[model samples]
Target chain A: MKDWRYWLAEQRGTLLAFGIFIVMFVIYTSNHPAGFTANVVQTAANKGVLLAFVAMAQTLVVITAGIDLSVGMIFLLTNCLASWLVVGTPMQTTLGVIAVLAVGLLCGAINGAIVIYGRLQPIVATIATGAVYYGIGLLLRPFPGGSVNEDLADAMTGRVFDVVPASLVVLLAIVLVIWVPFSRSVLGRAAYAAGSSETAAYMSGVPIRRGKFAAYTLAGLLAAIGGLFLTFFTYTGDAAYASGNAYTLFSIAAVVLGGVSLFGGKGSAIGAIFGALAFRTIGDLLFVFDFDPLWQPLFQGVILLVAVSLGAFALFRVRNRLEWFL
Target chain B: MSETTPMVGKSNGGIAGRMPKFIRRADPAVLTAFACIVLLLFLGSLYSRSFLSPEYLLQQLKVASFLGVIATGMMLVVLLGQIDLSVPWSVAAGAMMACAAAAYGPAGVVLAIPFGIFCGVLIGIVNGIGVAYLRIPSMIITLATNAVAQGLMVVYTGGFSPQDSATGAMRYLATGFAIPGVPNAVIIWALIGAAMVFVLTRTGFGRTVYGIGNRERAAYLSGIDTRRVVMIAFAVSGGLSAFGGVLLAGYASKAAQSMGDAYLLPSIAAVVLGGTSILGGRGSYLGTVAGVILITLLQSILSVMQMPEAGRQIIYGVVIVAMLLLYGRAPASR
Candidate 1:
């Protein structure tokens, strides 16, 4: 294949997911009573960005062939923490935000340490750490009553210059500042390399451990950002278990939809972000169609099933049955 | 013997001689589970005198049976190096279906158990078809199935709480004592466990599971009917999970919404804690039994200590991670 063709093939999943998001978003907005107004878009963007951040977080660890079940819990934990910390004076709010982000970073680091050094499987390790994070979060806001800095929350969630949603801008900024650098850097390449073939990467001196560690730690940071946004959107810190699990599940769905392989070594955060957005739009699409809210889970599942089934078409082409296991 | 053969035999014997016989002969996971059970019992007794009582202990056994049943099925899938995340909803669907069936006449009650298991079987087959035939990843497929099951249940219940209650037979199966001081649930679990043991140790099907887990390609090349094995494993797992849910409904006397939600992680935890390789193909029901017991005891102790739900969750997750680290780090035994 030509170089561009190879690149296009590699980017196909991401592009497809992006297209899905656009189509869904356009449908959603067109169906809305206000019809594609800035306010409606802002609300959608705000909701979509939270999952987008989490999906991005998921994308990082996934690229290294690991899954972090705790990302959602970390999102919850930081949300709970942010409610308590991101309040009062501007200086205090700034410090509180930093503290929440730092806590998220720390949580990710612990996950990395256990998975890489302790040699625990990522699924179980994160599930455990996720529980611990949730426990602390429960302790932090046992009754679900905490305050965040209102001004900061509004500024972060609201539209900028009366056009683009501020949350989308932040999401883009994160992509640029964090994702762009990491994906272009040595450690990031190492992560991709490790995910693709750890033995080969190790033989090639790819710093597999450090690369994976970075992926995990950065995943934590991204989840924390989601948590912060959750606080901003909800204006409260509730340790809601269902919501936490939902986000975790949705993030996985988004990752898969975005073209990031659950098997690892392929896909991108950009695709995951779009995947998240598209998934969120699925729910909104139901709302606009006046379906009973109770049907949302069923609808989401059916859509997910269809979307995922599309990926399975590739399997039919596999000549060897053994490749099925892989 | 040739000079090289003699030297190789001598070195092998030397290494064998230096290692402890017990370590070499026994599976470490079973031993660890046994130790943990003892430790948990000791701690439970220390925490509260009631914990040592026969009634309390038997009650714990009964409770453990629910998870035990589910974990048994989970182990089969794990043995195949795949997973069934659809367990939570499968359990729910089973309980709900059984309860709904019981709401009918006497005939419905008679068919309740089979009906519930059939529900699970149906879901399992769907999961299996997706995994075995469609070649989708089990994690995503099962997860999606779970969501679909949940949605169906919700729709069936008209978006409200389920209206049906467990029938007398269902209740008896979950709560009644067949032998003195032995709950029916425990009996059910034991029977299931025995059947699993027999199948795993004495049957070609069991060997196929291990073979597939170890290397599916090789297993297929050896003409093991790998797809059939995968489907059966998933079907068995789904049936067992549903049986567990039905029992749970009987125990609770009603099927509540999301009742199966709590079991998904614990089922995985019990199977993994029992020393089953999450990567598949190397574990025993005995270890799973021990794991189930230990977890039940630990839960009892934590509750006794007045630990909140959050604390219990944290502890549960921590213990699972601890067990994974302990066992996962070891080289695959077989």
Candidate 2:
């Protein structure tokens, strides 16, 4: 009984997700009147993988009660930069990927140093930096025009074993390499403690400053990963690859739905991945419904608010002890 | 009140030290921003000899008036230690409503003022209710309002620029010139700024705004109506934004559905740059004044130089970051 309680406590997000998955399975079966196909699953997984990387980046900073509005801008910039960097050059495509990741780290470091040294609140600081990053993208390509290397693009977008996408493999590698170590490490544990209560953590000898610096830096790097993945999805880049402003909401929406409290501390990487999948699936479902495409922005806002509100309500009830069931 | 005495020092140490302790803090944001404006002007003049003309400057000030007036209300909202993200939408709504009213001539124009004020109040109330009672964060509620505004504007105008007008006396607002040194709207904006300064310093409502902003729980405990104070703060912000929108309807000779979208970032930037706390209460109206000028001047300089939008945005971001480094830090925790 004790072990069961402990498992439930640690895996609440996963359990809630499983329950959702069951409901979704029943709904899809009834709607399609056929069992889920491999093709359908592959499509869902592909979209989920793209959003998952972005969501992971969002979760890292969000768990600290800070926001990185620049994530989308950084993604936009990196996608275009990657496309431009390896265009027709005999540069080892692998080396190009490494260089792109390095850029991501550098971008992340800039944000980390700004917040740590400049003492700007994460939201305001990021908003300003986002504009700058977008500007840099515009300079890279004044108009929206560029092509990706066909070979590399195919490797990323095409399936590895005809069942799993190459992009998915890279995304998994990221989760395995970065998110797993982060979730299990002692430093990761201290980061959680620091976020939970800065003063208490400081008193308990946790390095709050260092943890925040590392967290933001990782977020920046993850944003770069999101940008790289985007190049696979999109073969071209211009200044307007994606609306950077959207990141302010998408990242937030994913993490909040994934069960990370905006107030900081206590969340999971797997939960973030699920949340991103759910978010992307909703968008896909909207496409299936074939509503006016312009309704997308409004739909996104409503869905975001609904998802966030549900989380907020759950949090509020838990915090206020408002449960009334007999 | 005692806590804010230190804020005065944080903003302008000389004023705090030389003046009476009871003297309020001038917004350091305003001073720094003004310096930035002056520096930009000198650079502009140096780069292009013809940039310093009164006519050219008046044109710039006219553009600035739109943001400056709304920023007055934004200052009050920030003084209460909260944000109103709905300003962009509210401004858009006011412009559309005012433009619609202005179509009927003077009667419609006069009617537009109250109607505009009403819209602002309604939006403010909705925002306040969501934030205060429902306990949705102000950022989220106002952001949602922005989305609603975007949707509504698209529906109202059919995604096209609506014909409002500056054909009558309202044209004076858009293109009215006074002395060689001032545009009519700039003078009005200045008056509004002065009024804001007076309100923040002299009025009980203003002090309560600061009180609620600085410490909401303490303010409520001390018999201040903190929620009411916050509601009124949003209301004022909305009304002022509407006022700016009305003038805008006059200035542009018509209201475009998206005219207000650009004002939100700059207005909020002006407020923050002026040294008002993002959290609320300890700040200066003067600082916001500087913020408005700096932002306006930057836009003008960039426009004259024909910097691409991306590059301009980059510069704006960099300058803001630099300012944060200079003065935007939250005071080291005691």
Candidate 3:
């Protein structure tokens, strides 16, 4: 139980992020007299499904002290692959879906292979692969012209029931799937241990290489999920359109904002999701204000910086604040 | 390093005296970079006989020179353990400012290079302060600066490109071809590259920059003023990027607001391709020269091949991923 104290102390970023999210939700809900309708909640929840998934993938790799610069590129490739596969192909719909996921998984595996066997750094390797993958997608579809199956997109995007949005349901399902491995599994703890101290983690018998591989592999899978969402959301595959690489930095920011340390160790998947929601909520509200999109990048960068600064300040709780002066 | 290293090791044989060239093994990355360049060139040659012509090669050299000059500055910053993403816009800002200063005529022509360099240095200081003092990651801070700089360009140029026509030595810097067959821009880039190699290897500041990159805290603890070194590295980067802009203006016979656009990736690519560790601390300037040629060659090849723009970007990106993965993954910790 005493071990938990170190955790609570480390989680200031998570608390702050959640606090901000709740505040935004309250502000939006309170401003409208009717307040917090299913549609509004569904919209946020729907956005959350993909953002959180992508955020989780990025968070996992980042927590292992690596960055996947290629996640967006992978998403674009996967989305385009999925779109390309859907038209007049003899494969079953299930097989087609698998093929799309395979596109992402294959790319991720390539990333993993290079990162693991080739001894590449995550940032450099991913950036390079992303370019390649992006090129492949461009080759596949020089222009943005492809369609997702209407029925599948509709089903995937539709609300699960009257009370719960389908996207939220999917998100929860993903969370449930990850929770077991994340919390109870041996590999999971090793992931944290490896991130915390590679030498020590190795000395302590954590399979450092294997754990890192798993983390990246999982990140690849999760990025594919983001691609899957794009299939539903946009209802088309556009190679030229991007997952927006800024989101790569933003996801990192969200994780950092959620109080996940960039240097690895001490972070939570749930925290990342909340952080993403908090980030998106800010964007949503900003959109409501009708500010130009150009300002959004600058604004988001500022917010991310502030959030990190506050997190840094709170991490030391005045001790480092004094250290800054010293 | 290759010159001094083995001889130094022979004289001092004790444990502490044993030399460790940061490059411990025969690197596959250098080979990969070479292959990429060759492949691009081969494709270009296949695409058109003119691709191998001196006129075309010289033009390619001119392009390489501009980015190569900027890449040298970028490589230094990378050596210092940071990146300067604002170099793209900083180059643009330099061109625009130098073009604006052209109203001063012949004197302005000579002075434009320094003036552009000054804008870069000022921006570098701001970037340095953001990273070294305020401690924002160079990526985010420079991204903001990039946006701001570009936006400023939009406002200053009023969507029209800035034009400069320099008829004196300034034009000669970029336009005047050298002895035999070289374009002036190529000659200038080669001169700068050579000078940088000398500076990086011979100077105290250069050693300190590499030292600071290896471990900032350790350098500080060892009584090195890390902040000052970082500031200086960025200032140099700014100056070089500006110099590239100046030469670009001269070579083009006019300055455009977005002349620096193609430079961003290729500059970083050259640094990475050249075998400099993007993560800082373990690299060389000579590698940058190699990288510059490699990227320029590849770009020329692609352009000559006449592939679609998106395909070209993809090819470049994939090449980057390959290089990144094959070599130069930053280590897991500081």
User: How high is the lDDT of residue A105 in model 2?
Assistant: 80
Interface RMSD of 1: 3.0
Cα lDDT tens digits, model 1, A1-326, are 79999999999999999999999999999899889899999999999999999999999999998888889999999999999999999899899999999999999999999988888778767877888888888988888888889999999999899999999999999999999999999999999998998889998888999999999999999999999999999999999877888898889889988999876899999999999999999878988999988888888888777766665444875778667655
- Of candidates 3 and 1, the better by DockQ: 1
Off by over 4 Å in 2: A17-44, A313-326, B1-29, B97-121, B155-172, B177-182, B242-246
Clashes of each: 0, 3, 6
Q: Give the docking tier of candidate 3.
A: acceptable
- Report per-candidate DockQ: 0.54, 0.35, 0.24
Q: What are the runs in model 3 whose C-alpha is more than 4 Å off?
A: A1-7, A29-35, A86-91, A241-243, A292-294, A308-326, B3-51, B85-123, B134-184, B215-218, B242-262, B310-314, B317-334
Native contacts present in each candidate (fraction): 0.54, 0.43, 0.32
C-alpha-based local distance difference test score of model 1: 0.88
Per-residue lDDT tens digits of candidate 1, residues B165-247?
A: 99889999999987987899999998999999999989999889888988898898887778889998999999999999999
What's model 2's lDDT at A229? 68
Q: TM-score of every model?
A: 0.94, 0.87, 0.82
lDDT of 2 by residue, B251-283 (tens): 876666667767876887888877777767777
Per-residue lDDT of A187-302 in model 3, one digit per residue for the tens?
67777888888889987778777777777787878888888887778877777532445556567667776767666777887788888888888766666666655566556656
lDDT of 3 by residue, B1-334 (tens): 3543554455445642543545323243554566667777777777788877788877777778888889999998889878887877788888778877767766776677778779888878877777777666676566556656665666567644445564355578887766767777888887888888788888888788888777776777777778888888887888888778877877777778668866877788899887778778767776777789888787666665577767787778777766675666645532
